[model samples]
Target: MTSTAGYDVERIRSQFPILQRELKGKPLVYFDNAATSQKPQVVIDALVEYYSMYNANIHRGIHTLAEEATAAYEATREAVRAFIGAPSTEEIIFTRGTTEGINLVAYSWGRANILEGDEIIISSLEHHSNIVPWQMLAAEKGAVLKVIPINAHGEILLEEYYKLLNPRTKLVSVVHASNSLGVINPVKVIIDAAHAVGAVVMIDGAQSTVHLDINVQELDCDFFAFSGHKLYAPTGVGALYGKRELLEAMPPFHGGGEMIKEVRFDGTTYNDLPYKFEAGTPNIADTVAMKAALEFINGIGKENIRRHENDLLQYGTEQLRQIPGIQIKGDVAEKVSVISFVAEGIHPQDLGVLLDQQGIAVRTGSHCTMPLMQCLNITGTTRASFAAYNTKEEIDRLVAGLHKAIKILR
Candidate 1:
């Protein structure tokens, strides 16, 4: 359970107050990071300060308070643009979360570009957010939704994906990292192949943004989306990064106050770039906090944090493998810090309940990936995900709790 030296795991743990509390008189072990990471103090403080000090609607402001609030909100857009390595701030659009971001693209871009008899490519491992959006859009547009098959290990079959690409393929959206199984897909290659056919690619980065270094420009992806809560920020805030030319071509997602350039009885023109997509009064406090979360990651250095988490994942995988009768899912070389497994003769829900009794938190059930669970012919799995604040000792505690839970269930 010893952490690697040079990284102060103890000091890092102190930043999160929830980690300090005990569950059922035992030290709480949180491993449901894929669901939502616990926010750091800096992000929390930014939220409090924004509400306490400057709370006003952004854009079209004249007074000092409105100007300060507008600057803060716009600064978050710049931070998001930098965070994803987007080409311009105009390409960054704030949304409720990844779900809304995908839907925005589905409704706007999908409806505009995809016509009848066209195909939309997606993988079998996609979460419902990724799958359902395209499905709904395809049904609306009369376009066929084609699924890229995955192998037994839950990794996408790239050869099959390449074959699926044709002139009829209009859009390709895939998860950068699987939430249910921790598999990291070859997004760069996927994007490249999709672009070869002139089809636009959108990466659902809900899980990968926190664990991996994202360079949207380098990735050459048409669209990228991620949630703030999963990246140590508050909920109800997320961003969608699109290419400038593509964003300009698509229509606005929601029409309201700031999104419009001028309003008349005849018609109205939308605002430029991002504001056109961000309609109504936005999530001011959470948007400000998201910038702080990005700054916190930069302060710690994403590469160093990723290295530590990878080590934890390796250690956890090895330790979990030693436990008898444990069926590990998605044990592939290319993966993030997600592990899903099922104990023989034990239901996943039962295992989660037993682990929680020992102050350990793990996710059970389909994890919003019913199709992925069905692909593996299992009802669900017990998922344990890692984050920057996680330590080696936490993994040890998790393994110990899993063993005890298995024994109790048996």
Candidate 2:
């Protein structure tokens, strides 16, 4: 396993209370980080503090609790803005998760801009969240959906992607990284090419935001969406980063109490910038706690986290490759800490079950990217995703468990 000097992994692991638990007479080895990361005690304590101290609705109340709640909630918006290097807090609109963020854009921006003959482009590596919303938008608007092809290595075919761009290309929405394959795409190039065709680009940052350093301005993407849970934050909370001009131009995604300026029986005017997209009362407690998650990452440093995860990816890849019947998918040069594989004559679901019996948590399915599975000519894969707290010792346990699984099943 790779090592970075001065990185204390054990110290980091201690922060997560759930990691101390055991299952089925074995220590829990969590490898399902891609599904959802384990929350640290600090994040949990933040949630508790919010509920116990100042539990109130935000933006509408004038009391002390309301002011505190609103401040904490809005503070997260600024944190997210800095996290992704967005220009302003006004550009950050909070949503349920990555799925809702994409849907908001499709419903609001897609409906307002896309014409009958326009073409919307996406890659074969997108999650269903990124793909389905655009598909609905395209069908509703009579716009054509174009897909960029991928190589056998699971990297996007950049040459083929350029050929799909033309004047009729209205939008290009692609994932910054593949959730199933862990392949990091060249989004800046994709964005630049789409801009050349006068098309707006939206990046599904559900996978990338936690791993990579993202700057929306540098990437020049029109929209960027990511889930908070992927970055060690609470579920049901995410943020969408849209260009100021684009967010201002797009209509409100939902109509409700807070997203209003002057509501009359004749007509109602919408609120400015981010508030226009965030309708009604939001998940205030979770939103406030999300700031603590970001702080947790910042305290550890993203570089150190990346180094540790990459070490796990490398060590796991080597160990898994030694198994005779195992076939690893998506062997790309650049990837996150995810490994998807399948064994000969064994079903992934069955393997997942056996692994769980050994207290090894993994995900086994199409991973919400059925098209990618179909493209790769597989049913599904057993995925082991790593996080910062994961260690080489855990990978050793996983390898041993896989050997046991092979011996029993094969």
Candidate 3:
């Protein structure tokens, strides 16, 4: 509710109830934060409060419950608008998650604007969600899909990206950070380069929103999408931030109750910016609960969280580098709190199973970026992603688990 001037880590950790839970007689070491963060009691409580006290459909109802529910729902929008530093609340559109958000952009903007012989640009580090929707759109629109290749360290080649951008480029959809490699792209630079050639840019902020400071106005990105679940909120709720002019220009993604101004047998008129994108009933409780999650992060300070998690990344990277046969994936210096690695003679699945037996939860697989793995010449990597709640002690446990697993596997 206020500026995150003085962050308190311990106080913040105390708010998350799952952090206090034990798994198989040991405290849960939740290093799989990149997948979905554990929700705080405050966010959980918000869900309870909404369902228990004010349960009603919002916007159109006039009953007392509807009024209260509407206020709570609208508050979450304001919270999201403030969280991303959006120009206006109208610019923030609710979606299921990043996947749905990207799809919305593709269907609405890409389908409408993209033409034959036009090009759509994305990087090699994109999640399948980012890649598939654009490819589908490009195919449907008869537009060409151009990929900005990543170097050995998994960082996008800026020169290659710039060279790919020209008058033919209609849209540039890039991830703000890689979910698998943990590489944070120079999105502002990318956006500027795309704009120089008159292409609209959409940034998939699913990974970046949690750790980095975001000022959408400052970045001047045309569209920004992120999932609430990745940012310590409930799943099934996320937001899409678009510049007002662009959102106003684009057609509605879906046709339904809340998104319409009027419905006639022959034709229908759409509502304003955000409501036009959010069709039908939304994830009401989870959407309302997201404000509490954003408040929790705001209380802790995103910059402070970034500092702590970056420290964890550095510590985990160095410790894993010392292990025999262990190789870190994507040695990009600019990264978030995610560390993905592989061990010689050990499958990532086996490593994950062994780590879980020791109460160290980690993710191992393609991690929703199968193409990225193919590019890296690997099937998958065992990924341990950190949050503000994670600590050096947890990193030590991870390292210990890896050492024991390595000895047995070898």
Please provide, for model 1 over 1-410, each residue's C-alpha lDDT reduced to its tens digit, 9 standing for 90 to 100: 36665777677778888889899999889999999999888999999999889888777678887899989888999999888898889889999899999999999988899999999999999999999999898898899999999998999999999999999999999999999999999999999999999999999999999989999999999999999999999999999998999999999888888788999999998888888888899998899899999998888888888888899999999999999999789999999999999888899999999999989899999999999999999999999999888887888888889888888888
How do the residues 1-410 of candidate 3 rate in per-residue lDDT, one tens digit apiece? 12124545567678888888887788889999999999889899999999999999998999999999989999999999999999899999989999999999999988889999999999999999999999998888889999999887798999999889899999999999899979999999999999999999999999999999888999999999999999989999999999998999999889899999999999999998789988888889999999999998898778788887887899889999999899999877899989999899789999999888888999999999998898889999999999988878888989998989878778
1 against 3, candidate with superior TM-score: 1
lDDT of each: 0.92, 0.93, 0.90
| Model 1, runs deviating above 4 Å | none
For all candidates, the clash counts are: 0, 0, 0
TM-scores of the candidates in the order shown: 0.99, 0.99, 0.97
> 1-410 in candidate 2: lDDT tens per residue?
33557888888889999999998999899999999999998999999999999999999899999999999999999999999999999999999889999999999999999989899999999999989998999999999999999987789999999999999999999999889989999999999999998999999999888988889999999999999998899999999999999989999999998899989999999999889888899998888889999999999999889988888899899999999999989977799989999899999998999999999999999999999998998999999999989988989999999999888997
Q: How accurate is candidate 2 locally (lDDT)?
A: 0.93
Least well predicted 10-residue stretch by lDDT in candidate 2? 1-10
